[model samples]
Target: MVKNAYVHIPFCKSKCKYCSFVSYPQLELTKQYLEALQEEIKYFYKNEPLKTLYIGGGTPSVLEVSELADIIENFRFDKAAEITVELNPETLTKDYFKGLKSIGVNRISLGCQTFDDEILKSIGRRHNSEQVKNSVELAFSAGFENINLDFIYGLPSQTIEGFAEDLKTAAYLDVKHISLYGLKIEDGCFFYKNPPEKLPDSDTQADMYLKAIEILTGKGFEHYEVSNFAKPGFESRHNLNYWDNNSYYGFGIAAHGYVDGVRYSNYQDFDTYFKFPHVHFLTHRVTLKEQLEEEIFLGFRECKGINVQKINEKFSIDFEKKYSQILAKYTASNHIQKTPQGYKLSDEGILVSNVILADFL
Candidate 1:
């Protein structure tokens, strides 16, 4: 059964330069959007008592507390379920957080990006460094214990020292989790049309990633996933659902979900979504070969790597014999290390992970 659900809120105050996610600045349409969203959820949701529910979007914080609570009331959750909301630092207040807690929000993922004020402005982020600090304080004061700060490395004009300082500042805040990402100027973003100056090179970005691992690990955070670190018992259970290749339900325009071996995505345009709120724009039934490939690709993303016995039993194949050549190649180069359970990427291996994982595909 699908035990996780994700709801997308598409309203944002403004678009960020480096963000290509499907979010709109038309706050005027929020009421209509929420109405349509409720309709979609009513038609599709089976009320399975979700284990995790993530409310993400262009800016979910832009909605009123009553509106957000209305959305949450539609679902049934397990007693220990994790409910996370993504918020921007600028839009948060102590009362806002308290209201969120009252409605059962247990985790907050703030889009901190960086503590460098100039860099934040360059990236078209609305919140400043001071706001982020204040927001964290407010969240804590509001009784939130599970908080995550997101940071981006390799930003334009961001030096290694500057990035290190950003991570250190986040760690010092005593948040429970941190997520690090390398900047990517993808199409549909302002940076794609007008590239920023002094962007760090690929090699430099790799260095920043390694440095983050060293610093965060030293600060008592576990590198549980490729891009996420957390204090013990504070890992993101919602995201862990995704990395585990489990099935989930996705509601709202531009959201994607995988369920019962079929992956589906909703329409990206508001008009299309409103007209056919219950219809999926695209759906693909994953084949056995593709599932095996995904099992390997997604499993390797975790620090524990793939469980050989589990894979063998799940796929009814001899794990090592099937990919002996690829295994031997990387193991010889020390890129992949042999673990008691299976194999995992070494520090060097993670740097060229794309190249290695592609070979498996």
Candidate 2:
């Protein structure tokens, strides 16, 4: 029924060094871009009364409250809908949070990469640690109960201790959710061209990730997903929709969607996107084999891991027999462990997840 949707706001005041996402520092095109987005939504959106709508971007906070409200008004949401907006600390204010609340936004995900002021500058982030704290306070004051703080573990000049402190501070702020990611200097980011010094090694990053799990869980957060931890009832429903392999609509430049077993993405280039806003840049109908692989890959991302019974029934294959060798190898190594429902990756397994998941592909 496509009860979930993701809208991309491609404009940012400036680019972050480690970000390679399809975003631009072109606020001048905001009006035109929004118009194009509306056109696309009008053409494709079926108004299914979305259960979750996530507005993500180069920086969605760059837009005015009224503008963001206008975008929200276009969608028909369920009564209990989870509408999330990704914001930068520097661009938020108490009034801004109130405006978002008035327009039906129930969740706010703040980009607080680190608490170290020096590391913040090295990564080209516009806000500092204090701003992050202030923004969280303002959000809470504005009556937002579901707040998420994002942190990167392996940034330039970032240390394990510093990252642990960042997670602790987030917990102290009483946010509902936290997402941690290892830094990947992908192509198209500034770091790709001019690599920063003092970057942590892979092993260090792994340690930082484990440390985060320890700190957050100790604070009564559930490590529900590999990269996400949340208070009991505060997991991100929009993102959970993705990990569950459900269908959704994607709007705006570079946004990807999976609908009716077909995965599609919009154009990344501004010129191309504006010209063909209603047309998808690429579409691939998922094959059964690919779908099975995806189910395994995505399911394993969760802390609960894959349900072998469901997989066997859905695909009509013997889960153990088909991948007996792989399962035995990982199980013997204690990297993959069996659960009442099925199996999940151990902490060490997650460290080498790429290598493990690749074998399934």
Candidate 3:
């Protein structure tokens, strides 16, 4: 029943200042890590022709093309499946892109956080702006028409004008998708210990977001999700599987997966992961009430909000009566609107989406 899969590669040449994900800079662990990852997949993968497969990482691109191929060969994919790999621009080579295409990788997500070299250094990224440009050109030449560029706003020394320029540059690259995120200093990150100076305030960050929505939508990208924009059919299918609450397999250290109403995450420590990669460090059986709450919170993240009729039918509850107060307050305040499909977040609502979405929970 699982149709989507995610493989985490924790290896990186160097870690970023704000990255809190479980990633290691040790290259010596590459061989053993891949072997353990394959074993984990072998244990859980159902051998179905998958709908989507995403290889995300500290740096999946750092591995040799042959090593990447060996891992992919174990999985069976649909003929037209969306296979995506997260690539660090500096690690990409023409031959690597070619090898990926040969192995049926149809999508490429390049981490081009910003086009400013000074900001790049400030954040500890290894690649320069030129490397990002070359990486996109190489991906296109390798026959990957579905490409996504990830950019961040509200970084140290970032300005509204600078972020707008970055978006303009991204649009010029002919990419099919863009993921724009605001920087947050989470615990365990270098930024948490040493906070960056001149970071954007909440108001400035909101302005930056609104500006991006104007620019990207003007360039024909659909604002499908809170942080993602895409061309009509280029929305990330793998991610949509998550928003839709579908079951999938997640493999590797610190990777999380939801299956049969239970959510589980693998161990975070490398030694413990090698000992038992399939054993979950945390597991929670979601209750029906929690599922209903999640369906609303996650669904609202997309432009297409929760379907009232569907919720009523599926949960056998009066959708309107249950949330009558919430509906009345938000709609009256112009934060939500009724549509032919269902109730959706207003444009203004999307600006404060996190705050409003919490009310649903």
Alpha-carbon local distance difference test for all models: 0.94, 0.93, 0.90
Each candidate's TM vs. the true structure?
Answer: 0.99, 0.99, 0.98
lDDT tens per residue, model 3, 173-228: 98999999888889988899999998999789889999999999999999998899
- Report the lDDT of model 2 for residue 62: 94
lDDT of 2 at 32: 96
For all the candidates, what are their Cα RMSDs to the real structure?
Answer: 0.8, 0.8, 1.0
Model 3 segments beyond 4 Å from truth?
Answer: none
Arrange candidates by lDDT, descending: 1, 2, 3
**TM-score, cand. 2:** 0.99
All candidates in order of TM-score, best leading: 1, 2, 3
Q: Per-residue lDDT for 1-361 in model 1, tens only?
A: 9999999999889999999999999999999999999999999898899999999998899999899999999999999999999999897889999999999999999999999999999999999999999999999999999999999999999999999999999999999999999999999999999999999999999999999999999999999988999999999999888888889999999999998899999999999998999999999999989889998998888887888998999999998999999999999999888999998888888889899999999
Which residue pairs collide, candidate 1? none
For every model in order, what is the number of clashing pairs?
0, 0, 0
* Candidate 1 stretches greater than 4 Å from native: none
| Shift of residue 8 alpha carbon in model 1, Å | 0.9
